[model samples]
Target: METVVDGTGRAGRSGRRWRITSMQVLCALLVLAILGQDLLREAFDAPVLQTAATVFVAICVQALPFLVLGVLLSGAIAAFVPARALRRVLPRRDSAAVGVAGMSGVVLAGCECASVPVARRLIGQGVAPAAALAFLLAAPAVNPIVLVSTAVAFPGEPAMVAARFAGSLATALIMGWLWLRWGKLEWIAERALRRLPDTEGRDRWRVFAETARADLVDAAGFLVLGALVAAVFGVVIPGDWFSSLGEQIVLGILVMAVLAVVLSLCSEADAFVAASLSALPLLPRLVFLVVGPAIDAKLFALQAGTFGRAFALRFAPVTFVVAIGCGVAAGLLFLGGVR
Candidate 1:
């Protein structure tokens, strides 16, 4: 029967994958053993290498709990919630749904890392992909914790917080509309569309646990990879770039935007980082805050893992451009030419 053939094929593939993973792990261990502690110490003695390692560990430690929370929430949504019910709850019109999704982001208090898996779950659960993506972009930027932190970080600059909120919200909405208009379903990885099997009977808890564990493992690996990449950039990027204000305003905006993507700071703390860069004008800092949550190295890795490389490649660049423009417009309107 066809079912038997399919099952056999699946088992064969699983076995091959397991063997490959084991071999890879064994090889890694062997290499590490060969290098020994003295080599590692020698390497770490270099200032740049040491700094990168420190950043890698710090990012992993800070993000691990939120990543766990994200996977667990995603698993709960998959196991207990009905896609039909979610569809019913969302607005009928896609445009309206996008707006609703952007606004709904206020409820999620976690950082950018948390939103990646959650957005993928939303798409798999029958929500419009564009709307879900909007929520993903908005959540970390516009959440109450982020807003409040911004307020506290810049005590006297109420306009800074307002501009940040407005710019981030605008970026989300614009990306949603752009996706709806131009995005192709095939651009998303096929794996993202596949639904988690139902566990209505005795296997509900097992399903939840398995789903969460698998997502955690997969996402955590990519998160670590991203953190490593970010660490390298962190060491390479000059500190003087933040300290020295360039005469050309456009250059400052562009540098801040690029730095945001490179830094990959947590949304809850990014406001403080931006605030600490007092040498930069409010406009550039606003761009940094808005762009960090929307698209960063870690977020891009998470997206590529969750959605697809094709999707991330197209999405991240567009988001960067949109965030910059939105930040500029918002700055002009709210900060009145960047105080």
Candidate 2:
């Protein structure tokens, strides 16, 4: 009876292992099937597929340097800047802190990918969640690099740059205030709330390198996914659709907002993409700029991972609404009715 029981247990274990191996093999085959470009092209015989692959590579190449810079900066901040020192520099009042945080984004130039970890670090270091959240939203949108890129992209229209900056700043400030008033403490992940241990000298450098490496690997996967999505849509959407929607301003705005979320373009390169959409009015493009940096597929996933699902669920939706409103208001004030 004992021998029979042991035999049954071994069979069960072997069967489980075999199932796992089969699943792994199936997944690998599926991935290979998709990546089989020549076979795919021969089967579908579509030029759009080729164009999409080109666009995907182009977007990824264009955004890589900025993403590297962002990750390095994030790592540096994590390693060298003591949370206590940061807290000492900022105001104690939540409102005041929010203001300072928004303005600070001008100096801490980074893409949205970099800001999530830094914001988590800030929160762990005892900074107010509202202030950290404000900084997270503002850094990518209002930074000098992003602003300059906007200026360069929309060359004869300085108003676009101003509108983008104003809309982003206002969105960040409003989100901060909203969090201050209503954000609950329990929404943040326990992991995000815990502070890192203080280190010195060589250890700091080690921490910097390790943190940057991990951030790069983690962010790169999502960045690639975003680029792939953008590329696919770029080819799938007909060119005339943009021109057709130009007449309907409200529809243009809503579509651009949704595109911003779906595309997940890096803030530095997004200006160029927005500029390329010449069919749309500047107002909708401005909405794209403001919304992209604040809440996109990549940003949403990172926020959920770093801050808690509950926080992202509430925060991302509110930010989307606030950002759309601010974009329109800024467009009116700066672009003078978006001609």
Candidate 3:
């Protein structure tokens, strides 16, 4: 009887493993099938494909510089900066720190995924949890690389680029300020947030290696999830569906926000998606791209993993409303011509 019970347990475990493996295989096959379809190959023959390729490449090229810089800066911060020094430098007042920290994105250039380790490091370094949170929220959208790629993607519409940057900054600043004022920092932080190494400095190379490796491992799941959803959206949705919905910016923004939750696109690459949204008004798409880095389905997963699930539920909606508002205002101020 005992032997039979053991056999049943083994079978159950095997079945579970098989199910997981089967799902992974199915996901891979789906990705390949979509790539094989005209949605991907059509780019080779169609001028629109050329535009898509241009947007993708430009986004990648533009983003790499910022990714490199942010990673390096994070490494340096980890290596040389002590927790006490950081705490002393950082304002304990959440509103002030969060507002100022949101603007720090102008200095660090990284996509949403790349920003995680840097944010974790900042939190670990005792830079006020609110400030670290702000950096995580703002770093991806408010960077030069994103700005440039967006400008190039929306050629002839320079205002779209400006709106994206300005809107992102405004939303991030507001959220950061709020986080400082009311955000439960303790609930979000892991035990590492409190640990202080006796050593003030570590070897730079070692710090870089450790941070990059740890971050990639920890955050790669979110990236894969984001990429999978983006790929799926490219395959499943007709490129012009948003255009068919009409020229209403508010409606389009709402729809895009829903789509953002599903697609989980990296902020660096989202402008390409936004540019492809030819039918959606410029402001709505800009809002979509700006808001996405802070609150997407996969990014929510990443946040839950990094901080806690409780934090994400409260944080996401607040950021979403603020982002859309910023985008709308930016549009009115800069894109009156965009219907």
TM-score of each: 0.67, 0.77, 0.69
* lDDT-best of 1 and 2: 2
Alpha carbon deviation, residue 167, candidate 2 (Å): 1.1
lDDT for every model? Answer: 0.78, 0.83, 0.67
User: Highest TM-score, which number?
Assistant: 2
Candidate 2 residues lying further than 4 Å off, grouped into runs, are 1-65, 199-202, 214-235
Ranking by lDDT: 2, 1, 3
For 135-159, candidate 1 gives per-residue lDDT tens digits of 8899778877678778877899999
Report the Cα lDDT for candidate 2: 0.83
Give the per-residue lDDT digits (tens) of candidate 2, residues 298-337: 8999999998898899999999999999999999999999
Which 10-residue span in candidate 1 carries the lowest summed lDDT?
11-20
Residue clash pairs of candidate 2: none
Q: Model 1 clash tally?
A: 0
Best by lDDT: 2
Higher-lDDT candidate of 2 and 3: 2
Residue 190 CA displacement from its true place in model 1, Å: 0.8
Pairs that clash in candidate 1: none
